[model samples]
Target: MALSHSLIQLLISLRRQKFIGAGEPIRMLEFGEQNWFYDVVPAELLILIDEFQDVPAERRQALKAELQQILDTKPPTEPFDICKVFYKLVFNYEDYTAVDLHGTPQALSLDLNEPLGLPPHSWDVVTNIGTTEHVFNQYQAFKSLHELTKPGGVIMHSLPNQGCFDHGFFNYHPTFFYDLAEANRYEIVALVYADCSKHPHQLKQLGSQADYVRLAVSHQLSAYSGIFCVYRTPTDAQAFKVPRQGYYDNRLPPELQQAWQNLAR
Candidate 1:
C-alpha cells in the first residue's frame, strides 16, 4: 500500500500536463495501506527499497544516494499536499477520517469487488497505485472506480504490464483500457508502456489501441514495465455500462444469431 516514487513522478507530470488543476483538492480512495508521501518518496530513492523491495541494504542505499543527487537538480513542483503525492509522511494514520476534506487529500477505503458505498460521482481523482492486480473481480473493481469518479474527473492507475511474474492476480495488457475506453467513450490523456529508469524514467506515448496491439509483439523490453493510464469521464455521464469485446460485438455473427436471439429473448 506504500506509494512508490514512480507514482509520484507520474502525478507531478500529470499536474504539469494540466490534467489536474493547481491546488485542486483531490479525494482519494485507498484500496489498501497508505502512508504519507515524504516517508516513502524520500529525497533519496533507495530508502524506499525496504518498504517494498527485497534488495541488499548497501546496494539500494548507494543507488538511491546517487539517484537522489540527480533528482535534486530538478525536483517536481509541489503544489498539492504530500498526502496527495509521494513520500511516506509522518502524520497519524488514524486521523485520515477525522472529517471530510474541503480542500485537501482525503483518504478513504474502497473494496474493489463490492459497491463503493460512497456518493456517486464524488471523487475528483481516483488512483489505484498498487491494488487492482490483487483484486479477483476486475470488472467490479473498475466499475466501482468509475462510479466513484465525478464526471469530468480523471482516474489513473499504475499497473504491472510485463516482466513481473507471480506479483499479483493479473498483469494487465493495454487492451483492457483500450477497449474499455472505446466502450465507455472516454478521453485518454496518456496510456503508455512505462519503465523504472531513474535519472529519467520514461513513458512511451500511446497513439491508438489498434496500433499499440500491432506493435506489442515487436517491442518487448526486459525490465518490469507498468501501464500508466489517465481517463477523463465525460460530463453529463451516468453510470458506466461495460462494453463487450469488439470481436464478439461484430454483427453478432450470422452463425450465432440463434444463440444471440435466445439470449436476447
Candidate 2:
C-alpha cells in the first residue's frame, strides 16, 4: 500500500472520531492528490496540495508506480469520480444529486490546474483559502481565476501573515494582497485577520515571548494576515488582469474593496 493511502485512511478514521473539523480534505491517489469536495461543499472548495517539486526523484518514481497499481486494481465506488489525466483527481461528483433536494445544493470540487472550462458566468463563487502563497507562479494562477469567474462573482481567500511559522516550502509574502487585486482587476470587498492568538491552545504550543513576538510582528507588518479577503469581480467588461505580486486579487468590490485597499496601503 502507498503511504498516501494509509494517510487517507488515517484521516478518515480521525474524521469519524470528530478529530478533524470541516476543512478541505485531500486524498493522495494514483495520479496525485484528489480533492473530495462532494463529501464536503461542492463548488466552494478547491483542492491544492503543496510541495510537488521537492519530492525526491526516487520517491516520486515509487509513488507513480504505486498509484498506477492502485488505479488498475481499485474499482470506482458509486460516489467516486476518477480522472486519470492530471496528477490530481476528483471523487464523488454525483454526491450532490441527493443534496439538491435538501435545498442546500453543494458546490463541486474544482482542480486549479485543470479547470472545468465552463463559461465565466457558470459559477457563482470561487474561493482560495490558504493557497496562493504556495504557488511559484502566483500571477498566472490569479489571472486564470479572473478569466474563469463571471463579472460580479464572489471570491474569498485566506493567506498567511508574515510572522507565522513556515508550514510549506514557501513562506508568507506581504505583497500578496495588493498584487492579487491589482492584477485581476478585482475589487476588494472585505479583509479580516485570522488572529492566531485566538486559539490559545496553538499559542501555548508556540510558547515564549520571542516566539509570540515573531508571530505578532509577522502579522502586524503584514496585517495579521490570516484569511484576509472577500472579493468580487468587476462589473466592467475588461478581461481579468493577473497581478504582478501573487496569483489572484482577493479584494471584493468598489465600496468594500476600496476600504481594504486603503487599509492595506
Candidate 3:
C-alpha cells in the first residue's frame, strides 16, 4: 500500500529475475493500501482483498474500460490479464478477517500496541511499505511481519530516511538493514535509496548500497528520500528476535567500527 509507480516497477523487474519465483502463488500481506500493485502485478496468482478504492466513484467504468483496453492491446508474449486482476483478501483489526468480493473496505488496523493474532508463517510475502514508522512499537510490528512470513518468504520495507518530518515516528538508514541481515541471518537481495521529492518521471534510478558515500552525504544534507530493502527469511522457520542496533551487532568489522566511532583528531 502507498506504493510509488517506480516501486511497483521495481518489484516487477525484480520478479522477472525470479528473485521470489513467479509460477507459485504469492501470498502477500500489505501493511497498508496496495492499489497500484493491482495494475501491474500478474493477478492470476495474486489473491488479496483490495480494500483501497483507487479509482473515483464516477470514474470506475472509465478505469475498467482502460484496463480492458490495455489487456486487449498487450503483446501476445506478455503474461496475465492486464485489466482483470482483483483484490482478494481483507484484513481487519478486531482479531478477525473480513473480505468483500466487491472490493469494499473492511475493518483493519496496523496498531503495534495490539496483537495481530494471525497464524504464523501465513504469508509468502510481507510488505511494510511505509507503515512501520507509524506503529509505536517498531520492533513488535516487525516481529509480527516475521511471524507472518513463511520460511523462504520475502519481507520488503520502504521507509523514510530524510527530510520528512511529521511523516512518522522514525526515519531509517541503510545500515539498519545491513545490521539486520547479520543479526537475523536474513539474505538481503536488494537495498537502495530513492529520492522522493521529485516527480516520478523526474526521479533518478535508485542508488544501491554501493552508493553509500553519496547517500550518506546527501541524506546528511537533508535530501528527501526513502530506503527500500528486501530480505528473505531462512528456508526453515526461526524465532523472531529483535535486531540489535548496527554498532552493537557483535559481528562488526573494522570499517563498520570506524564508521560508528568518532575519530579523535
Q: Tell me each candidate's RMSD, in Å, in order.
A: 11.6, 15.3, 9.6
Model 1 alpha-carbon drift over 4 Å, by segment: 33-41, 44-110, 196-202, 250-265
- Residue range 1-265, candidate 1, lDDT tens digits: 4455566666656645545644434554444444334534444334433433333466446555555554566334232233422321211112122111122344444456676676778766666666788888988888887887778877777788775678889887666787787777788888866765432446677776544444443454435777888898888667677867554667334434443344322
Q: What is the number of backbone collisions in each predicted candidate, taken in the order shown?
A: 12, 25, 5
Candidate 2 stretches with Cα past 4 Å from truth are 1-118, 163-166, 171-174, 200-225, 244-265
State model 2's lDDT: 0.40
Residue-wise C-alpha lDDT for candidate 3, range 66-131, written one tens digit per residue: 455655676542222231233221111112232112222552543554568878897777777777
Consecutive 10-residue window with the lowest summed lDDT within model 3 = 87-96
Q: How big is the positional error of residue 17 in model 1, measured in Å on the Cα after superposition?
A: 2.3
Query: Each prediction's TM-score against the native?
Result: 0.64, 0.41, 0.69
Worst 10 residues of 2 by lDDT: 92-101
- Candidate 2 — number of clashing residue pairs? 25
TM-score of 3: 0.69
Better of 1 and 2 by lDDT: 1
Quantify all predictions' global Cα lDDT against the true fold: 0.58, 0.40, 0.58
